[model samples]
Target: MVVALFNLVSALAGCVLLVVAGGDSVGMPNEWLARTPFPSWAWPGLILGVIVGGTQLVALIAQRRRYVLAWGPHAASGLVMMIWIFVEIAPLLVWSPLHGVYFLTELVQTVLAVLALGAWPQPFFARMPRRSRTGVGNTTDTPA
Candidate 1:
């Protein structure tokens, strides 16, 4: 439950960042992303944010299912967010003559993504059964 909420928050935050940092007018962190070659990638990031955030929202609705389909989308979106942050965003922030705000925001968002994935209920929640493995063959209870 907590993981989902964190993911949702992070996704929303990321979306806001992408929207606000659409162009190169700003400086440092914000401008860093905007200056990247494929400026259009921001749109994908925004879409990913919506997907991740929506996944969490659905998780809340389907609590009793033990596992929800949202997990896959959440994980994919997280990966995309990480790629954008590290590959495109980080370089600019690191090399450019920018302030620390961009780095700090990146750090916080990274932590949130880590926590969300680490705390996810379980990857196999839906496919696996609850029963424990006995590891005993009915034909031969004794060791061969």
Candidate 2:
């Protein structure tokens, strides 16, 4: 559910970016792309809407439908978000609080997806006590 909401927001934002031709409309300056390959916001906007947003859409659908290995798409979308931010900011050499916020959001998404994959001991939300695992918190067989 959390990932779905994030995906919706991201997709909407991306679509908006793609629709708007100028960076000024989005509070960005055309100068930012002076040192980069993009002559205008069109390419970035397309990439954001199609690549980043599309990935999120896929993740959301996979999760909602309970597809096989649904967590895989979630994890991939998280990585795509992170990479998109990095690539977007790297070329422009610009930074903003929004970037940090989105990066953290993606990080959380990735962690949650990993947790959903049953990477650790089983029954994460079970009411029963947690037992020790090899090389984990407690080595003993007793519950913690």
Candidate 3:
């Protein structure tokens, strides 16, 4: 449920970014992207939202729960993206005192994905049990 909710939000956030970039550039300002005449972050956020958010929403809705492949290497992928804007390309190469709406939304999406996989080791990220030839679920222990 949480994953799905975040996914939906990400998609909507992405759409908002595209709209603001094209129609209301002044609504949200980011010193990093403002350096360029073109609103560079919007396009990438739009793309990420469509791809990552769309599939995650669908998978969660269908209860497929393909966490490992859902986001194409999952949280690692999100981390990589956040790094580009928050680290390498971002001014001062450190955390910004204030982040734009787009950056915050993406950061939320990334945090959500990582938290789900890391929590409880099962509840949010429950995996199907594998069966052994004996017709019982696989266990960590072996008959001694």
Candidate 4:
């Protein structure tokens, strides 16, 4: 429950970051034409915000003891968030010229968000017992 709340909060924060960052430049047609000059961080941040927000929101709604869509997307989004964090950090570490305080800030935020999602309690479906070959529920036997 606590983890879910954390994820929700983090998702909201991500959305705020997206709005403050000026959204995705690539999403704007004029960007490709070079008519508008937006920071490179805009696009990736916006993408990350949407993905993370959607995932967390779904998880939160599902946690409320309601029907949840596929858990696959939620898990995938968590993984994507981690990947996005790496993507954000890579340039800063590989290219000294890109060093900035914002890089570290993003790193911390991403780490926190990942930790929150990791700590969330497993859904009942995830913890449910599987059926054995004999057609009985197998709570302890490992599948071969």
Highest-scoring model, lDDT: 2
lDDT by residue (tens digit), candidate 1, 1-144: 465556567667666766666433233344454556545546745674665566555654454364644444444444544454466445564544222334344345445545555665565454433333674434433333
lDDT of 4 at 129: 58
Superposed Cα RMSD, model 4: 9.5
Candidate 1 ranges beyond 4 A from true positions? 17-31, 38-45, 58-81, 87-139, 142-144
Clashing pairs in 3: none
TM-score of each: 0.41, 0.78, 0.38, 0.43
TM-score of 4: 0.43
Between prediction 1 and prediction 2, the one with superior TM-score is 2
Q: Whole-model Cα lDDT per candidate?
A: 0.51, 0.78, 0.53, 0.50
How many clashing residue pairs appear in each of the predictions shown?
0, 0, 0, 0
For model 4, residues 15-93, the per-residue Cα lDDT tens digits are 5665564434323232432422345445544665677656656655664654444343445545555565566445433
CA RMSD of each candidate after superposition = 8.6, 5.2, 8.2, 9.5
Quality of model 3 by C-alpha lDDT: 0.53
Candidate 2, residues 15-94, lDDT tens digits: the string is 67756746878778888888788878788877787888887888888878889878888888889889988988887788
Candidate with top TM-score is 2
In candidate 4, which residue ranges exceed 4 Å CA deviation?
21-40, 68-74, 94-144
Error of 4 at 65 (Å): 4.3
Least accurate stretch of 10 residues (summed lDDT) in model 4? 26-35
Span of 10 residues, lowest total lDDT, candidate 2:
135-144
